[model samples]
Target: MNIEKFDSRFEILPIKEIIDENPTTKTFVFEYPLGGKPGQFIMMWIPGVDEKPMSVAFDDGKEFWVTVCKVGPASEALHLMKVGDLVGVRGPLGTHYNWGNGDHLALVAGGYGAAPMYFVAREAVKRGCKVEFFIGARSKDLLLYVDKISKLEGVNLHISTNDGSEGRQGFVTVLLDEVLAEGNCDVVFTCGPEVMMKAVGEVADKHNVASYMSMEKYMKCGIGVCGQCAVDDTGELVCKQGPVMDWKYLKKLPEMGKYHRDAQGTKHYF
Candidate 1:
């Protein structure tokens, strides 16, 4: 028998800076670029804490940033670090969103998902595509990237908060529905919570709009050797084949929004 193995060759780089987006979230900036595209993620190692995959929030050709939300031990450790701290970075790995020739694009984002979606919107608008951003959070305080996305010249921003403290009282999906009714979107892109992505997928399907979503999976080996991020029916690895997949293809995935397997492959309901 023969076997193959390889190392990720992670790089330890110093943090350029950190900007607090809110209490729970902060944007970590690094003076490095792996030529990441929108929707692609990098394995970020916090040394003694742990490593995790984080989506690229901002990449300006010279540097890149990842928006981290301190939800657990590893991330909380990162939250405590200062500007000059060192962290290991592995890749701009996984497939990214495919940009086609579309004039009008609609992006639906919830929670920290705005990071990657904002990246997409930035790149898209730069290519002359008019973007409409539908963003939602639990309340006004939790919404990510509102100020950043609003500054883009031709992009229109619509916001929603669960507590009715923002643009709309319900979900961002309501804005999606309204945008679809206006019949102007050529493509719809969404990221954030699984439930929000699932609902966005359904609405896109109903409106016959081409849609793409970034999936969140419990990734072990970010390069896909561990098989921990496999989507049940498709047998596709999120760390390898996606994080970003078309809505049409994802609708056929039985384990998409229903349940996802843990690191041990135990099914857990979302």
Candidate 2:
């Protein structure tokens, strides 16, 4: 793996604040000079520990934020980093969601999926698109960014939780069905668990709406060298070709749900 180092000065930003979204999830805000698109992600590095890919939750050009759940070694390290601690960031990489061409945009997000969609909704509203957001989590406490997304213009926010702890008790797909039954949308965009995205894709297909999905994979090198992140069917490199892909193109990947071997040759199901 020929990983290239970015020559620009990488700033070590302090953790400004952490907002607990759920018992297991928290939104961490950091201060950093930003230049990134809505769906792009940054490689977060913890010195002497590990690095992981995290999407920018929000950005004001000078400061940015990321919402993380304590899921693994890297995330655990991130959660332990204090307000004064330093963390390395290397990107804003991957293709961004296209909001310019769509007139009525429908965004479906689940779990931490809401992080990147928050930025996408902001940009869509800024571009004068009628944006409707359908967000879901396990329960009420798992939902994040409700207050912030609600304030954006032209955004119709709908909520759902599996345990009925908040808003609607059904899956987000139910709400999407209602929305589509009521009217039509120009495009549909989503980021979430693979099953969730696949479900959303089916609905969007039925509605004849253009759909886009942000595909998540374990990444080693953020750039396209390591071959660690390859899509099954088309063999496209997620780091180079996309973390975002058209729904139609993604469905064609041969290895979509087959065997994904890790560095140790351990097979994992997608």
Candidate 3:
């Protein structure tokens, strides 16, 4: 395992291609090879619009992808850019998921969380680990990366949609319960909404299985300076110390799902 470092300098990279993942989401394939570890993120800047952190959706040494969901002005600007357009990228930053722990791994993904989880699944499979994916979405239209993940060599995918339009009709955590009960999970990796991750953490705790998750917070500096994304309990910066942490550590955090601070350090309900 090699630790990656960037000079804190930004790179202006051109977008090579774009794939519409859904009505509101798009995947941008970059012209440069950003060999980022799974769960690491890049700071994307759109000139005067805004800059935000996006998880590395796919990275295969030669090419990488950033999956963006149109939620705000910054992401909307990125969605409107043309193929040849260039965007300012400042990282492959932060900690990443670790592999080589166990042979059986369970992935719990909800909504766009599948993006980084897809990256994790790809690398895990190449190491000959058996991956059982539990993907959940609000409905069929919101699901992402199903085609790509299903095509992987050895992956057992179980899906659930809130409306019963996909696999079992329930939250993804429900499927995780079944997998953990079968005594098949060695480690769990999840990325999704904070509420969902908290629930997954609880379940993993009940089974005494090791689980890890990617956390999302309002970030301004992307590096550890502004203190905008610090947890209320430990004051740990998600941009520097984490974004990925173990379930045992995360479950004890007072700010895990209850509240998060904004750029002005205003606390808001999660």
Model 2: what TM-score?
A: 0.91
Lowest lDDT block of 10, candidate 3: 1-10
- Model 2 gets an lDDT of 0.82
Question: Per-residue lDDT tens digits of candidate 2, residues 29-62?
Answer: 8777778787788888888898788888888787
Steric clashes per prediction: 0, 4, 0
| C-alpha TM-score for every candidate | 0.96, 0.91, 0.96
* Residue-pair clash count for candidate 1: 0
Whole-model lDDT values for every prediction: 0.90, 0.82, 0.90
Alpha carbon lDDT at 202, candidate 2:
85
Model 1 alpha-carbon drift over 4 Å, by segment:
1-7
User: Could you give candidate 3's per-residue lDDT for residues 89-187 as a string of tens digits?
Assistant: 988889899878347889999999999999999999989989999899999999999999999977999999999998999899988998899998888
Q: Write the per-residue lDDT of candidate 1 for residues 24-72, one digit (tens) a residue.
A: 9999999986789999999999998889999999788789999999899
For model 1, give the RMSD to the true fold: 2.1
